[model samples]
Target: VLKDDLVYVADLFIGIQIINVSDPNNPTEFLRFGTTGANPRDLCIYESLLYYSTWYGGISVVNISNTLNPVEICHIWLSDRIEGLFVSYPYLYAANLEYSVSVFNITNPSSTYKMTEFHESVLVFDVFVVSNNIYLAGYAHGLSIMTLDKGGDLQEISQHFFPNHHHSLVIDEPYAYVGDKYSGLHVYNINCVANQRISVSLLKAGGFLALAIVLIKLSLKLLPKILEKLSPYKRGYGL
Candidate 1:
């Protein structure tokens, strides 16, 4: 989580580290807190409170109002492991390692509660939210796109599959860049999903054009041989 010149890092074993990047060349660690128990997997900052997810289970909200002495305001325990976190205004989305993305009502910040969850069979590694859509990065299931309905229920929009396991993802408008475990990085054109019918039509047209070209070439090669056999008397019959 980035706030002004300070960057809060979720150090797995060492807890969350508050680093001061006032100097670009040489940055120093200001403070490291929340190192008591479970490993911090991910962290998100909303207002003055910082929410950090733990690997063992649940998330802890810390009061970062005083950078020198941070205080733990609230702790909410949920899934087996919280891999990633994303906060959008009053709601906080957590990617559970078990199989789902849990949503929390963080309107009160300190007194937050679970609102809803989008469940799936795949292992959710990370989550990214944009507008009303929530994108989930899975271990072997690739990516899952879902939308928040009027009743706050999660509705599946579509799913895109890839080869290796997806560790993380970042969406920039029409494109999504996914980080794979083995194959490095993968870039996907998400805009095509909206125009799927048009894309399929274009692909079908291209296939037909390619087939026509192949048939024309074969006819050009075979016509001479057919003519040679038909007009045995004259080689240049003009027929």
Candidate 2:
């Protein structure tokens, strides 16, 4: 997670490592915070806290107000191993290797509880939230779109099945970008009625190792209005 000039990484081998990226050309390691139970899988930041997932199927919250000396605030374990973690304020969404995407209400870290689990008979590698829609990378099952209702339930909105293995997903306005294991990247027009996909092949050069979608300030400002028009409440809307 990027915070100012520092980037906090949830390293599988070394736990949370802080890197100073103020100098884009030559980045240096700022500090390292070791985690006990299991190796870290993913990281998410909100306010002064940093949330990280573990390979042993657990989540840990750390107080990162002081980068030099970070403290572990709380840690919670789940049933299945978590791969991807996305934090939207009070809600924390986790993608598990064992056929499910779990949602947790993080309003109170000490009293945090699993709100709901969207169980699908497929491996879910990543979970990303845009407005009320939950975009999931369901391995070979492709991208699954669901909506988070007021009752904290995840209801299916749409599904896009592809042959490529969907490993990660991110949405930017009119399009949804999906990272495939075999075939580089896949882009779909979520604004359209049929949701037209515009595949951009990046595997020609080499492997598609990482995917990052950065939204500029202007794009971020326009997102609220755009998402309102494409809200999941509308029937027959394809996303």
Candidate 3:
């Protein structure tokens, strides 16, 4: 969490710490607050609250209104591991280690509900939401953009294959910084009319290439007969 001149970082078992960087050259640790999560995988800070998704520990919400002495407001146990987190208004998106991204309604922090789980049977590694659009990065499926319907079912809008496997992604407006386990980091310009045009062009190019290959094969098949007819030794042998 970035708060003006202070930077809050979580060191998993070591808990969360506040670092004072009023002067960038000389930084100092200001405060340290303990965490209840066994192994904090990832966390997100919205407003004055800090939410963490832990490995094999579930989710924990902390009140960081007072960073020096932060309070653990609540902890929800899912009995499974969580890798990524994104807090949007009244909801918390928990990217599970398995194949689902669990959605939790956090309107009433004290009484949170497990709303739904999406991308089931797919290796969903990370997820981020922009307005109503949710960007999911899967192990094999790469990056997929989706939105939830009225009944909370996922509807895929568009997708991009990240070569081998997509591990994570971070979006900033028109650009998305994606990470692949085999290919490293990549920058993709998404959510624009230009991208749609590129998609159409790629489709057209693929169709043309397929047609060219078919024509080449047909020419090759008739090449032997044409060669025999063109040559003066046409009836010399089985040619």
How far in Å is the alpha carbon of 21 misplaced in model 1? Answer: 0.6
Q: How well is each residue in 1-239 modelled by candidate 2, as lDDT tens digits?
A: 66778878777788888999899999999999788457777777877778888877588888888989998878887656887788776798888998998898889876667889889878988887877878888777877888888887988777767766777655675666566666555666677423533333332213533322222222344446433332111001011
Question: Whose TM-score is higher: candidate 1's or candidate 3's?
Answer: 1
Error of 2 at 51 (Å): 0.8
Tell me the deviation in Å of residue 132 in model 1. 0.5
Candidate 2 lDDT score at position 150: 89
Better of 2 and 3 by lDDT: 2
Please give me the total number of clashing residue pairs in predicted model 1: 0
Candidate 3 C-alpha lDDT tens digits along 47-78: 77778767777788888787667888789987
TM-score for each prediction? 0.79, 0.81, 0.73
Give me the runs in candidate 1 sitting further than 4 Å from their true place.
35-37, 195-239
Number of the predicted model whose TM-score against the real structure is largest: 2
lDDT of 1 at 20: 98
Error of 3 at 28 (Å): 1.7
Candidate 1 lDDT, 126-222, residue by residue in tens? 8877778788888877778888899998888887665557766555546555555554445566675554311111111133344344334433444
Clashing pairs in 2: none
> Model 2, 67: alpha-carbon shift in Å?
1.0
Can you tell me which runs of candidate 3 are displaced by over 4 Å?
192-239
